[model samples]
Target: MTFSIVGRCEETGQLGIAISSSSIAVGARCPWVRAGVGVVATQNVTLPALGPQILDLMERAKLGASAALDRALCASEWSEYRQVTVVDAQGRTAFLSGKQALGTYHAVAGKQCVAAGNMLAGTHVIEAMIPAFENAPGHLADRLLAAVHAAIGAGGEAGPVHSAALKIAGEQSWPLVDLRVDWSDDDPIAKLDGLWQAYRPQMQDYVARALNPTAAPRYGVPGDE
Candidate 1:
């Protein structure tokens, strides 16, 4: 069982996906993003490759989120069992809950964002996320965090969630933020959020180190000094 929000920041042009699930390592299998392209979450009976396939359609084939999703599903033999969401660079959104989606499932689309889930407590889980994302402040990552928290507060999955992930794509080819709590007996979402707070301050430093090492700041750790 899984739930996710895929979004694009209109102001910063950042793209990201935040997800949590009863399954372990949900992050590695469900969320995918491209900095200047789009974000995708493939859950339920997850076909992880669908994430990149949708992105390829959006980026190389010049397709929008809806068209890309359609094309991706058209090629999938297991589309009937998948729950997927997409948010394009331009903030256009699309999502699908297949006929075979487990338990309770729903999807909600807001400005520049889409929230979707399968095997959820109820539709309220997704309904609560859109408004939270729309009104939340700070970076795209912050808004995504708000959405994830709101979903949990409203009523999360049908069962306890053991894993969570927050992934964001910015100017770099690699993810600007890729945090995951692969499995936790307690609250994985809270742990994932804590990781975000710890990572946020060093985010820019890491980016600078990659882009221009000569101008980047020192690590300030024992050996780096």
Candidate 2:
């Protein structure tokens, strides 16, 4: 029913995640990320609290991605029914998809990223995503988006995807960029990619202004200035 990618951006040092699902509002239900803390995507009987708890542990430097996930899983009564992927501030990645997860559910952890999904055509969906993310160029968000595309190409969620989203954060709890396709008739991945591209310039401009507001106005036209 869902597919997701969680990763730390190597270039910007920002952690980001993206997800799409056949279910409505998948963004709101599946993807979870904290700027400098970590990233999580809990699906297959989603436990939203697990997202923050794992992030809190990572923020306190109490555990890495693997250990944090292990702790969370061990403490949960429904652990076997959950699928989760985590990536810490340091870019360490880990993932677990319970044995009881829906058909075709699986997870993959890479050098600094993790991708997971459930209710798909086969495990190959997630397997293709791992390498796509690893070999993808550009910022963290772009790579995460690429992984989403790969999964969709690999047969996506045993059904049509209706929702998609991308999240990134750093230094603050608030998201630096959060874009969602709550519902779409067209290709969700391409729509998401277009959204990312459209948002990039604006996001860069906003960051620039926030970092150096005084200099930002200088880039405007002379008459406007």
Q: TM-score winner among the candidates?
A: 1
Q: lDDT (CA) for every model shown?
A: 0.95, 0.84
Candidate 2 wrongly placed segments (more than 4 Å): 210-225
For candidate 1, report its TM-score.
0.98
lDDT by residue (1-225, candidate 1, tens digit) is 888999999888999999999999999899999989999999998999999999999999999999999999999998989999999999999999999999999999999999999889999999999999999999998999999999999989999999999999999999999999999989999999999999999999999989998888997789775
lDDT of 2 by residue, 53-133 (tens): 788778785699989989888888889899989998888888888888987888888878888888998899999998899
Residue 131 shift from truth in candidate 2, angstroms: 1.3
Give the Å shift of residue 44 in candidate 2: 1.4
Residue 166 in candidate 2 has what lDDT? 90
Best by lDDT: 1
Question: After best superposition, candidate 2 residue 192: deviation in angstroms?
Answer: 1.4
TM-score of each: 0.98, 0.89
